[model samples]
Target: MYVAVKGGERAIENAHAWLAEERRGDKGVAELSVAQIREQLSLAVNRVMAEGSLYDPDLAALAIKQARGDLIEAIFLVRAYRTTLPRLGASKPVETGEMACDRRISATFKDVPGGQLLGPTFDYTHRLLDFALDAEGEIPEAQSGEPQAAPVPHITGFLNRDGMIEQEPQGDATPPDLTREPMEFPANRALRLQNLTRGDEGFVLGLAYSTQRGYARNHAFVGELRVGTVPVEMEIPELGFAIEIGELRLTECETVNQFKGSKTEPPQFTRGYGLTFGMTERKAISMALVDRALRWRELGEDDLGAAAQDEEFVLAHSDNIQATGFLEHIKLPHYVDFQSELELVRRLRREAQATRQDQQEAAE
Candidate 1:
C-alpha cells in the first residue's frame, strides 16, 4: 500500500526555500551583515580560521554569517573553500621566541624574564552575568606598562641546562600531512599533533581531564602558556632566501611532566607541546596533556589502555565535522534498515511465543 515518493529535485527546491526563510527570521529586525560579523565578532572569526586550518579572517566571517553563527558549520564552509585554493608555497617554520607577546604566563616559576604579562585574560573574573551587557556598554581602558625589551626565555630551558630533562632529538625528515592523505594507525607525534590541533575542543578537553584523573596520570606543570603574534616566512627557490610573508596570532603551550627512571637512564622531566591558532590557552593546555599521554609508548612507559593513550581513538573521534556528519545523518531516511529490524523483532517474538506454548502444553 505504500508508494515511494519521487520528484526529489522539486522537494529539495521547496525545502531550500523554507530553510532560507528560516535562516532570516523576523523581517522587522535588521539583518546582520558579513562585515558586522567580521569586525564585531572577531573571536568567532579567529576560532573558525583556527579550526578550518585557514587564515582568511574575511572568509571565515562570511562563512559565520552564512551559517548563522554556527561555528562548526562555519568551519566546514571555510575548510571546503580552502580545498579549492591553489597551494603556492610552504611557509618556513615560525619562531615563537620572536613572538610579540600579548599574553604570557608561567605556572612553574614565580618570576620570569617577561614578568608574566597577563595581557587580557578572564582568569580571575567572576562568572556572574552583568545586566549592563543587555544594553550597549563600553569597556574601560586598560593601563599599560613599559614594553619588555628582551624575549622571554623558555621555562623548559632551565631544566634542560642541568640535564634534568630528556633531550629532544633533532630530525630533518618532513612529517606526513593528515589533510593531503588518508590517516593510518600507529601515527607519529607530528601526525598526532596535527589531528589534535584540528580536533574538537571539547573532546580534547575531556580526554585531557581523564588523564589528570588517574587514567594515564602524568603530573603536569604548565611550563609556559603564551599567546602572541608571530611573523610567518616562506623560502623562495628563485630568490634563494626566505622572506617574511605575514604575521599570525598563535597560542603555544609547553607542559613539563613527571618522568620515570629506567634501567638504562636516570629520571628526567619530559614535555608535552601544544600550539593553536588564536588566544586559546585551555585548549592548548589540554592538548599538551593529551600529547604527553599519547607519548607513553615512545617514553617507554606502560600503556594504561586509556582513551587519551590510544592514538587511533583520539585521532578518529577528534574531528568535529566527521563526528557531526555521522551523528546528524541519523535524521535522514532509514526506511529499509528500520523495516528489516522490525521484521526481525516480529519473527523472534513469534518463535518465543510458540516455544512458550509448547512448554505450557508439556507441563499440563
Candidate 2:
C-alpha cells in the first residue's frame, strides 16, 4: 500500500503557486522592480554570479528578483539557464598582468611600485544602521578620482624583481569544465579551483578560518586581492583566430603560504591561487586559503586531517543547492520504510510476549 504513493507533481505545482503568492505578499504593496533589485541588492546579485559562473549582471539581477531575493535560488536559476546555452567556444586566459583593474591591493610590500588603490570597499565603514535608508533616500555620489589608462601592471610582476617567489609557467593546458565532467580523485589545479569557485561562500570562509585555527596550519598572508573586468577571448573557427567574446568582473586572490621547502622543492615562496566570477573578494580570499590547505601533498607538507585538507569532505558538502536538496528531500514520502520498521517492531514485541507467557507457564 505504501508503494502506491503518488501526487508529487501536484504537490510541486501547488507549492510553486503558494511560493509565488508568498513572494508577492498580499498584492497591496508596491512590487520590487527588477532594476531596483539589480541596483540596490547588487551584492546579492554578485554572489549569484560568483557561484553560478555566469557573468551577466542584468540576468543575475533578474534571477534575484524572480527568486524574491533568495540568493541561492537565484544561483540555481542562473545555473539552470546556463545549462541550456549553446557552447560558443573556449577563451584564451585573460592575462592578469594585463588586467584593467578597478581595485588592487597587496599586503606583502608597504611600498610597491604600482601603489595600492583602496577602490570600492566597505572595509572601514562603521556597521551602524542608517535610518535614512529606511526613509528611501537617494545614495550619495561617489567621490571623484582621476582614472588612469588601461593595462595596469600586476603586483606579482614586481615580486619577480626580488626573485623571492617561484615563477608560474604559462602553459596551453586545457582546463576541464566541472559541470560537464564527473569529478575524479586527485583533481588537477584547474578542477580544484573550479569546484571552489562554485562552492558555498560560508563553507569556504569557515574552512579558511580553520586553517588559521591550526588545522593543517599554513601560515598564509593575502599577497594580493584584485577586482575588475577582464576580457574573454575565444577562437572563432570561421574567423580562424581568437576574438574578444565579452568581459566579466572577477575577484582574484593570490596567497603567499609558508612552506618549509622539502628536499624536492627548494626553500622559496609557494602560491595559493583563487579566481572567482564577479566582485566577491571575501569568497575569493577564502578560496585561496582553502586551496593552499588542499595542496599539502604537492607542497610536501604532512596532512593534519584538517577539513580543508580533505578534498572529498570539502567538495562533497560545499554546494548549497546539492546540500539543501538532499537535506530537504527527507520530507518526501518514506511510508514504505516506516511500515517495514513498524512490522519489525510489532514482530519483536509479539515474540517477547510469547516468551514471557511460556516462562510464566513454566513457573506456574
How well is each residue in 1-364 modelled by candidate 1, as lDDT tens digits?
Answer: 2335455798899999987888898999888888888788887888788788888788999999888789999999988998999988888778898888998888998777667888788889897898898888788998978888877877787878999888778876778898888899999898999999888888999999999999999999998999999999998889999999899999999999888765455798899999998777778898999999999887788888898899999999999988988999778677777898899999999999999999999999
lDDT of 1 at 20: 81
What lDDT does candidate 1 reach at residue 316?
94
Q: Write the per-residue lDDT of candidate 2 for residues 214-306, one digit (tens) a residue.
A: 898788888888888888898899999988988877889998876768856877777888888878999999999999889888867787888
C-alpha lDDT of all candidate models, in order: 0.87, 0.84
Off by over 4 Å in 1: 1-8, 263-265, 350-364
Clash number for every model? 0, 0
TM-score of each: 0.91, 0.91
User: Cα RMSD for candidate 2?
Assistant: 2.6
